[model samples]
Structure formats: structure tokens, C-alpha cells
Target: MKGFESEMIQRLRTSDGWKFFGVLPQANRGLAVTWWVLLLLRGILPALFAIVIGRLVGAVQRGQDVVGPLALVGAVYLPLQILAPLHRAIGANLGSQTAAWLYDRLVLACVRPPGMGHLENPKLTNDLTMARDFDLGISGPPMSISMDFIASGLVEMIVGLASAAILVGYAWWAPLLLAGGWLATHWLLRESAVWRDRNTEEVRDAQRHADYAYRLAVEPFAAKELRLFGLADWTVDRFRSMRSRLVELRFQATKLRERPVLWSLLIVLIANIVVLGSMASAAADGSLALDRLVTYASAAVTTGMIAFGGLSWALDCSAAPVAAVLRLKEAMEPAGALVLGRQPADGLPAREIRFRNLTFTYPGTDQPVLEGFDLTIPAGTSLAIVGQNGAGKTTLAKLLCRLYDPQSGGIEIDGVDLRTIDLDAWRSRVTAVFQDFIRFELPLRDNVAPGGAPDDFIQSALADAGAAGLADLDTVLARGYEGGTDLSGGQWQRVALARALCAVRLGAGLVLLDEPTAQLDVRGEAEIFERILAATRQTTTILISHRFSTVRHADRICVLEAGRVVELGTHDALMAAGGRYHTMFVLQASRFGTEDTEEEGVNYDVLT
Candidate 1:
């Protein structure tokens, strides 16, 4: 909790180095004005009480009537006390609601991006933690640094001055006592800041430890491996160690904070004692009148220094997550793919899609994924691209879709450069069903028409994809909110294939197939090819597959090697030429005769 407070303080402090709750701060004017008014009232009301009470006592001592007036003053005090609380609540509530709204907008802004790229840096991660922790009540920085808090703190300080002035008039030591209260608060915050900065890197390590514990204990994906390897016990041990180390680091940071606060508090205690003693001496010396003494006591009660100190402690608890959340907002604010307003994809002059002399590399990768790559899908035709694994087949699909742009060269859809057209507009006309296709737990009809319309043609798509007998399509879709009844790999592929067809029916003119049938049995593969041939009969298609049987039917076949297209021809032409395509076909077709399936280092090459 102490560590969270430190983080929260850092968050509330401006990037430009101004403190959030600094005396004479430049915060929201209305909130500031409201606070000063409330403080004036709080300070004035208490002094009024002391003055009235003292007068009543003075009159009664003189044997004059005092009951009626004292009763009236007491009545006013009750409502005034209630108003102070109501005012604080109103301001705090207003500030909290505003903060929540800002947090939500920041989250949605980050979410608009195509990927969570902003989370790559430490500053952003730390800032988010600050924002999150601060939003909590008296527990965190958000609560402490909020507009209401700023108002309240300033109000309290002003009221403290009322008490300070009263003490200073009768005793020189009273000024020192009030100064000591501020000194304690100020020194405590400064020490906290120092420890906060010192432990930031360690806190990150602690965060990672916490994250690992969360994954081990809660995430479902790791449960299988953990259970299979008898690792649940070992993981529990690891979590315990990480948690213990994190707690120790937090404790050390907290101790650094506590020392300064304790020393400052000691100084304040001494200052108050000296002031109290001086006031007593002045009264005994006849310099202090009883009526005046009562007034000063009322003013002293007005300060609420004890409440301030307690509030400071409570504020830290809420500030940790609030600070984290704010930091997250800062990080989230600038990251993600920018989406411009929608554009119409129609009237593109050329129908062909071409990649010319394209060379590409992923960020953080040294080896080029695509080297001077060139490929073209002509207007209204099918093109088969065959490649060995890791030969950049899938990378080409990503580039084509503009999930990424190439490092050099460019892709042209028709004659217009891909860079010039609207991305979402271009993407809309193209559809893809990857090997790792999504199996949405939506209704069967909705899944087939996932990105398109749910219309009467749902039956046709399912029948085409070979899930025709899986029960009534609508009934199958309805059966499972429970992971959608768990489709077999082949069945899911068929569903994905149907989804692509529905996309075509809804006006998608081009489709990219990325190993769309890798999981299918031979019979299923045959059915898939027939479906593809039918779907692409009228639209352009770029087919990516390892099966020569699938590629042989395309109007054109292009072979890729080391990120370059090494061969392009009709399947029959390549076969007759007896080069790479012909050689690979013969080799792969020969695999059926082997008793064991060959993997990566296998020596079952037909040529060998």
C-alpha cells in the first residue's frame, strides 16, 4: 500500500514537475473556488462557535441570562457540521465520475488500434499502474490528488491559519507548531518521492512476478501443460517465492517512507507542547483573557490536522492502482493503427493485384522475410502459390491484406498503389480463411456469415463446405454457448470455408487461402478443393497450399524458394519441363507408400 502511494504521488505530479496538491496550485477554477468558500465557512463557523460559547460563559459568570443564545448557537453548529460533509461528498463524487469517464475514453482509444503496440515500453506500463491505483478511495493517489482532495486540503490549510493566527497572537511558539504540521506532511511526501523513484525498476520485477503467478493460477491455456507435466506443485512453489520477494521489496520501500514521517511527527509533537506551555504561562501572567482563551481553543479545533494525517495515509492505499491507470492512459493514448474515415473501394482502375520487387523484414528480425519478391494475380483469375514451410507464403498474405506494409517496393491493387487507397476499403473486397481460422462460438448461421450478412444462403455455404449433415444448421448454431459444441478440426475448416463463400456472396471479389485444408483428411481435402473451385469460378483467388493436387487445378501456379518466386507456369507445363514443381510433386506423391510419415529431417526424398 505504501509503495502504491509513492507511485500515485509520482503520477499526480505533472510531467512538467508541478505537484498536484501544492499550496496555491493552478487547478480547475470552479473546484478551487468551491473549496476556498467551504474552507472559509468551516474555519469561520468554528471560530464563531468559540466566540459565542465564550460570551455565554462570560455572561453567565456575570449572572446575566445566557441559555437562549447558547442554544441557538449550538443549533447552527449542527447543520454547519453536516454541510461540511455534504460539500466534501459533492466535490469528491464529481471528481471521481470525471476520472472514470476519462479512464473509459482512454481505454477505448487504445482499443481502436489494430494491435496493443503501446504496451511495449516500461514508462507506459508504469504510468498505467499509477492511473489504476489512484482511482481508489482514501487508499490511493487518485483519491488524494483529485479535485475534491485539492480543494479540501487547501480549505483545511486555510482553516489551520485561523487557529495559527489565534495562537501566534498570544504565543510566539504557536506559529512554529502549525509550521511543524506542514513540515511533517511535506517531508513525508518528499521522502516518499525519493523511495518511489528508487524502487520503480524493482516494482516492475515485482509486477512480472505477480503476472506469472496470475497466469499459473488463473489462465486456462497453461492448465493442460501444467497438469500433464506434474508442474502444478512446482508452479505453486514458484508463485510463492515470487510473491515473497515482491513483499520484501515493498516492505523495504515502505520503511524508507515511514522514517521521515515519524521524525517529522515527533517535531510537530514537541512544537505543540512548547506552544501549549507558553500559552499557559501567558494566562498565568494575566496577558491571556479567559474569553480570548476560549476563542483560541475553538480556532485550534478548526484545523483538523489529525484528520489530514489520517487522510494522507488512506490516500496512499487508493493511489497505487490509480497511478497505474493514469500511466496506462498515457501509454494507451498514442499507440495503435490509425484508422481514417471509411472510403469507397469502387472505381479502382485495375483489377490485378501485384507485388513488385518487394523486400520485407519484421521489426526486431535480422533475416529478411521477403527478398525482392514479385507476384501478380491477374484480373479475374486464380493463382496458385506453392512454397516450402517458412518460405514466406503466409507473410505474403499478410502483406497483401495490408496487415503490414512492405519495407521496400509496394503492392498495387489494379494500377492504383495500395498506399494510396483506403486500407479498410481494400480489405473489404478481399477475404481470407487461414489454417488457424477462428471458430467463433456464435450460432452456425452467424458463424458462416460472420463478417457478412445472415441470409437465406447460409444453407448453401454449409452444404458447399461439407458440414451439410451436422444437424439443422440453425439448430447447431443454437446448441452451444458452451464452446459451440466443439467442432472437429475438419469440421471447423469446412465452417471457415463456408464463411469465406458467404463473404464472396456479400460482394468480396478476391480471396486469399492460407493452407485452408492442412488439417483435412484426403477425402475432406478433395471436398475442399471442389468447394474452392466452385467459389472462385467467378472471382479472383490467390491459393496458398502445399498439396500439389490443389495447385495443379489453378489457372497458373507459382513456386516460391527463399522468398523469391522460382517458378511460374501451368501445372502441366511445369510437369513436362520436369523442374522444381515436377520434382516436388513426384516426391510428395510418393509419400503414401512409406510405412511411416516423414517429418523435417526425413530422408524419404524420391529423388534420393
Candidate 2:
């Protein structure tokens, strides 16, 4: 018995119903307190009005004055009418505030961590999706509208309970008979009604599928492809099918079962018949007065509190996201968490960055992307890494930027372990143009110097990147705005390179460029490479690219294969040694060599 009681208590505390109450205060304390007070008054006024009616009836029967009872009725009825709209107005404000609070918490959980592991974790997708779209009214009604329904539902339940308590004035058994019957409907038909648990995997999966199909249909990114492939009708059909499946699953979970519904109706019918019949018999026998009968009858009728309805549905939908946001606040912090260090990392890779016996695989993979990788890059020198796709070239840059720590071994700055350095400070000293760098739709100046720098400094960096006169500094990068324009692939690459150069001017000590000039032609790439080397002469630089034209300009070049360095030397030395680098360089150089020139001559003669 004790164990069962403890389990019930635990369930009650964690239930969405309880969480709904908890969210009220988080929205606004003063408004929540006032809303509650109004709700309580609104709930009890029905019983109070009933009692006043009985008093007026008794006064008429006794041939006494009816003025006092009439006055009492007006007083009680007036506030009962006024309280609802007032309560709803307060609820709207509270609802908006609650939505904002949840969003604030969700944003913090996503970005507060220094590492990005949690954002990539598949396990969190369901909850993350739920919290993100809950208030948008896609899955259900938005919180602002749902708040009114929720308040009405709670007030209805309260009215039933308060009305039932009034039955105690007649007979104790009368209150129990009425209240018990009404309350049983909740437990008996819970699974059949608005009480389905949306947290079930099957339901959430259906929702995800439906949401994906909806996005494909509505989002602009997919619109062009959808129309070009003649898949518009197919997209609609897919959306309809997914939604139909979701509706089917919801019905299976919550559809009313006939047996339970009938049982509940019978229970309520018997309770009402017995209680009212007893009151009728007492009145006929003159054992009960007319006024007493009137009061008891009203209280007995008011016990149909759950009949106001939608308490289960509205509360469930509104509170699910609140619970999810709270859970994520606890779960996400540790999911993407990194071990932070207190040591300052300013200007200390002053010597050399060393990777010693390093081996790393991604979070969920088995094969190591970088195995036993050892390299040393002295300060103020440039090293280019060349590898085929998936040879862990970009993975090396991610490690240097501390985006993910290696599973074994470690990187050292001079002699201090890299993980022991302050994460933010270390990141501040490093800048990179990643293969998938973000293109913020802001002003060009802000895009180039996102942390804010002097106009002259940003212009100089832009000039170095061959991006001068590409656009005005204050022009937005996206074409959606009035004074904005979009850039071609090559132009965007120059802007990205300019971003890295701007960082170099702002005290960054390490620069990592991963295929920074992939869109530029061979000659243009070589020119940009020379400019980058000149600007970063005093900083440690690492470049990752497959183009020999760019790698050949580095101070030393390293050739990687199968996560291992196969050759490391100056370009001429590698070419003279006739190793892997020489073969690749020769193959690329031959593409533009004698055969291509002769082919071009033949084409020119034909045109002439």
C-alpha cells in the first residue's frame, strides 16, 4: 500500500497537469496570482447564485421581504459575468509571456554549450522539434488561443467540485454520489478521449513525418525542384498520406471505446436518479422545505462539472512543450558539454602546434578518420594538407578549432595540452574558412568582420582577398533587402576569404583555410594564395585543398592518404622524389598542358 501510494504521488507530480500549474508562475507572478484569484471566484459564484435563488424563494414562501435576496443575486451574478472576460484577457498576456520564456530557455540550451555535439544527436530530434513548433499552431492551436480554452476547462472542473461541496449541507452521501460519478468519467474514458499521451514514440514519429512532408510542400528551398520535377501533386499526396496516418494513429490511441462510455453514462445516470429521487420523496413527505429542495437540486445539477469539457485536450497540448523545454534545459547541457579549462590561451601557441599520436573518430562512427596522426606546425609558417575526399583533411581543421576533442591522444600548444586551455580564448585566437561556412544575410562589413572592426581594416582585408569593389561595405549580402545583392560562387568565396583575413587583423594567431578558393580558376587561386600568405606571414596557417596550384605555394606541403601522412616536403623536393605528390601534380599539370593547347588551336582554326 505504501509503495503504491508513493508511485501515485510521483506520477501526479510529474504529470503534465501539474506542470501546467508550474508554468503559470514562470509567465508572470502578479498576473498568475490575479488569474487564480479570479478563477476561484468564478468557480464558486454558480453555487453562490444558487443559494441566493433559494433564499429568494424562501422569502416569498414566508411572505417576507424579497429585496435583500434580490440584491444578493445581482451582486453575485454581476462579478460572475465580468470575471470571465477579465480572466481571458489576463490569460492571453500570460500565454504570450510563457511562450517567450520557453523560447529563451530553448535558445540557451542550444547555444550555451561550447561544443555542437547535442545539436547533431538524433535522440534529441523529437523533443527539439516539439519545443520549436509547439506555439506555431501547426500540431495544435497556438498557446495564446489555447490559454483561453485551458482556463475555461479548469474553471469548469472547479465549479463542479465547489457545487458538489454545497451538497454536504443536505446529506454527506449526496455529494459523494454526484462527485464520484462525474470524476469516474476522467479515469474510465481517459485513453478514449483527450487524454492520449503524445510522448509515445509512434505518435511522435507520425508527427515528424507529417511535419517533413509539410515543409517540403511549403518551404521555398524545395519549391523550384518540386515544380521542375513535376512533383507538386506528388508532394501534396505525400503530405495528405502522412497526415492521414497521423490522424489514424491519434484515433487509435484516443478514440472512445463504447463499453467505457456506456459504463460512465450508466454510473452518472444512476447517481443523479438516486440523489434527485430522494430529494423529491423528502419534499413530497414535507420533510424538506421548498427553499431547501431548490438549493439541493441546483447543487446536484452542478456536479456535471467535467461536462464543460476539453480540460484534458487543452491542458495536454499546452503543457507538453513546457515539459519538453524544461527537460531539454537539463538534458542538452550535458549532451554537447565539453570539459572546460581555466588556463588562459592568449598568444601561447607562440611556439608550435603539435598533434602527437592523435586518433579520432566522429561521435557515432566506428572507423577512425584520423589515426595515429602526428604533425608539427611551427609558429608563423604555412603548411598545406592535400588529400582525397574523406581522407580527414577537414577533420584536422575541426580539431585545431576545438570543435570536437579527439577520442585518444591530444594536441599540444608548445607543451601545454590543448584541452587545458580556456575554450573561448583558444577559439578567439583561431579563425577559419570552413568548407561549409555560414553566409550570414547581413551587411558585407559585418559579414567580413562579424565581431566588429574598423572600416579601413575590413577594407584592407577585402582587398587582400581580391574582393575589393565587390559591393559597398554596408550593403546586405542577401538579395531579399532593398539595397542588397547576391554574389556568384567565386565572389562568395572571396568574401569568405576576406572574413578570415579580417580575423587575422583582429589578433587571431592561427588561420585554417579548407578549400578556400575552390570556386576560383587556377590562376586566380594562385594569386589569392599569394595574397593570403603575405597577409598571414606572422601567423600559423594551415591549408587544406586538392588543387596543386594552391598547395605548391605553401612553405611545405603534406600529402595524406588513408588518414596517414605519406609524404611531407617542399613542392620541388616532393616532385624530385617522384612520390604520391609528384604523380598527382603531374596528372593535374598535364590536363592544361600540350594536348589541351593543341585542341584549343584546332578549335580556333575551325571557328576562323
Candidate 3:
């Protein structure tokens, strides 16, 4: 019992536990005070009822008027029935508001970091899962439920003392024996709670796997493949396998807990037998009056009921979740922390942007994605990067957009290192549309004008991106909304392009279009690239694609292979050299029976 108390104190002293307590007053001080007051009343109510019952029994046994004692019992029971509903309603409201407050902080803690490093960490991902599982409302933080348990425990202690005083008239040792029995029961119950807390991590991991399998089976994105590939039964089997393991572990824990509970029950039985037997013996010997006998028996039974009922269960249920909350909070703290820079990037690059010996590797992997890579783009010029898959073309764009920092060396905009500029201010000047762009489930206007551009600006961007006939501005692009509809892959691509154009309209200076025309047809691809060149004529643009014909329009083209630039020049120069780029371009143009000559610029109309 002493060890258990020490553990509880240590858990409460943890940073997350302290924050949990801190949120109560911060959410609403007046409401917190009221909640505490209600807890006090709830705690005392049980003892008050026990006392009233004892008094009424004494009055009836004495053959005196029992109306006063009966009315006192009514006074306690009637108000309690009314207050129970009120208490629950208020508690529910408080839990909801507190959950919102905590959830907001949790989201910011996960997302406010400057890079995607933490998001890629498995440990942080697990912590995030646990934090989300034990959210507010009925399954809220331990402190919320602990208040009721604390109140109940206090009430039981008070009632035990009063019962002991009444029983002392029978024998001085009687109260001591009863108190010892209750203490033993409490200790056993607390041991079970401790065991549960110790094993929660393993159980939570199993549940997460089970939940993931279920989501894969039910989520819309996987539905088509699940049916066509006949994977529904396989997914169901996986879910069942995980669930069965979780259930087996839980059953074993429950069986282990039953032994301590059996010991607690034995203690209760012995204590009750001794006290009741002594009371009957005294009554038969004519030493104890009938009224005193009734009063003592009632008080003893009430004390035992209070000791083992709601209070014990509450203690057991609240312990594990509170500990989990604390663990998750500590695990989710950002490692290096997000610090703001004093220097602001207020305008476009005046000279040039340079990547100086940049080296990088993704988290958890030793293989370098970009190794001593070097490149430069003059301001207001178009640069096209052509490469096969896994050439680190996309990685360079990610580094430039500051989604990650390089392992060594750095990128410089104008004369300042990218890291020294304010992150948000720098990001605001860059706009990108990757091959795997987002298709927002919103109105067409919202999708095209993601930066909240004016309607005229949205229409202009749409026209520039060649998406004016895709949908009306007011048309919803997803189901669940009134008059909502879905779009084809090509149409969604056009809308994404329009979103990027809208960003450009809103003052973004660095434009990146990575395989932006991959989903478009031959004619559509040519038209969109022409429009893009015209639109970004005054901005620094980097285009990545595998098609040589589309990249021929850029001011310069670079070929990347295995994380390094192997060739850099114009289309005509690369073709004349007949090197790696010339071989790929010839191979691609050969399929369409088009010669790689300077006169006809490799006709792309038939390539798609």
C-alpha cells in the first residue's frame, strides 16, 4: 500500500500529469471550483444517508415517533436523486470543453515543428495514437474521474470513523478489526490497479494494430482494390487475428486480478461474521437495548458497502489512463524545439538561389538521398530537371521548400542562408505542385483559390491553367455536400494546377511544378506547359518531368542520375553531345517515329 501511494504521487508530479491538473482552472476557474464543491457534496451524501438510516432504525426500535428521522432520510435521498442528473450533465459539459482545449494543444505540439522529422519518428507516432485514444468526455483524463473517487474515499473514511465510534460501546477492539479489514481490501484492489498500469503499453499496441486493420478494410481509398483484388476476407482475417491476441492477453490479466479480489472478499466475510455475531450475543444477554442493536448493525453494513463498492472500481479504472496521458505528453515534446528567426524574407530573390554541397538522408535510413549535390537557378529564369525515378529530383524540391534541412552544407537565397530567414515568411514566397498533389474535397472555387484569392483572380488562374470548363466555381467537388460531385483524375489535376497558379498570383516568387502534366493528354500537356511558361515568365520556375519534349521549352535542362547532376545544357546542346540525355531523348522519340533533329523540336503530340 505504501509503495502504491508513492507511485501515485510520482505520477501526479510528472509534467503531463501536472499539465492535466493545470488545465482545469485554465479552462474555466469558476466551473472548476463548482465541480470541486459538487464532488464534496457527493462524497458526504453517502455518509449522511447511512447516518439517517441508523437514526430512523433507532427511533423505530425505541417505539418512539419515527417521523422526524424518516423525514431527515427523505431530506437526504430526495435532493440526492435530483443532484445526480445535474452532476452528470455538468461533468459532461466540462469534459467536452476541456477536451477541446487539450486537443488543440496536442495538435500544435505535433505540427508546429519546422521540419517533418518528428512526423516520421515511430515513437512519436505511437505516442500520438495513445494521446488520441484517451481523449475527453467519459473516457477523459484521470483527474476528471479521480475527483469522484477521491470524494468517495473521503466519505468512506468519515463513515468508518463514525461507525467505529458507535461500535466502541460493544468493544474497544471491534473498531480496530473493522478498520483493518477495510484497509486490507483497499490494498488488494490497489495492487490490481498497479498491475493494470504496468501492462497498458502492450495492450495499447495490440489494440492499435487491430484498429489499423479495421481501418484498411473500411476506408474508401482502399475499397475498390479490396473488392477487385479479393482482399476483403484477408483483411477480415488479419483483424480477427489481432483481436484474438488482444482478448487472450486481457483474459490472462483479468484472471490474475481475480486472486487478490478473492482475498479481499474473505476479509470482508470474516469481519462481518465477527461483528454481527457479537451484536446478536449482546442483544440476547439483555446488556444491549434493541435500538442500539439496530443502530450498530446498520452502521456496520453501511461501512462495508462503502468500502468495497464504487470507490474501489473508480480507483482501478482511473489509474492507467492518467499514467498513459503523462507518458504520451512527455514522449511528444519536440526534440530540438521550433525557434523563430529574426530575419524576414520579404521579397523575391534578387540574384540567384544556390544549393552548396547539400547532403541529406531520410530518417531511419542510412542511404543518402542527396549526396554533395550542387545546383543553381538564376532569378526569373526557368530550369527543367529531367531524370528517371529515384534520381532525387523531388528531394531537391523538398529541401528548397524547407520541408527538411540538409544533413551538411545548406541552401542560400540571394546572400542569406535559408535557415536564417523566417520560416513562414520564406514559405509564403514559394509555391509548388507535385506529382502527387492534393485533391481538396471542397467547392471548385475553394479548390482553385486555396489562398483565398478574389473571384476574378481565381478565374484568371483557372484560365491560365486551362481548367475553365472543369466545373462551375460554386460546384462542390466531393460528396456529402448539397449539389456536390466528384471529378476525373485529369480534371482534379487541372484544379490543383489552378491552386498553384492562384498562389503565384498571391505573390509567391519561386514556382515548382513536378510532373504537373503527367495526367494530361498530349494536346493538354503541350497547352498547359505553354500557359505555364507564359504565366511564370517573370518568376523563378523549376520543372521536373521525364518527357524530353515538354522540358525542351525551358531556358535550360539538367539531367540528374543517382543524386547528382550529370549533364546541364540546352536541349539542342545535349542532343548534339549524344550522351546520356541524348540516348534517353532518342529512345523516347524513336517510339513515335520522330527524328531528334533541330528543325522539328521532337513532336510530343503523338508521344502520349
User: Which numbered prediction scores highest in lDDT against the true structure?
Assistant: 2
Question: lDDT of each prediction vs. the true structure?
Answer: 0.65, 0.85, 0.73
Greater-lDDT candidate between 1 and 2? 2
lDDT tens per residue, model 2, 330-420: 8888877887888998896799999999998876568999999998888888999987789899989988888788888899998889999
Error of 2 at 173 (Å): 1.6
The residue pairs found clashing in candidate 3 are: none
TM-score of decoy 2: 0.90
TM-score of 1: 0.72
- TM-scores for every predicted model: 0.72, 0.90, 0.83
How far is 314's C-alpha from truth in model 3 (Å)? 8.1
TM-score of 3: 0.83
Deviating ranges (above 4 Å) for candidate 1: 1-100, 111-173, 195-205, 257-262, 294-344, 347-351, 361-368, 382-393, 434-446, 450-454, 468-494, 515-522, 543-608
**RMSD values, in order shown:** 7.1, 4.3, 4.6
User: How are the candidates ranked when ordered by lDDT, highest leading?
Assistant: 2, 3, 1
Worst 10 residues of 1 by lDDT: 599-608
Model 3 alpha-carbon drift over 4 Å, by segment: 1-8, 15-25, 133-176, 179-200, 257-262, 286-289, 305-339, 364-367, 386-391, 547-549, 575-608
Q: What would the C-alpha RMSD of candidate 2 be, to one decimal place? A: 4.3
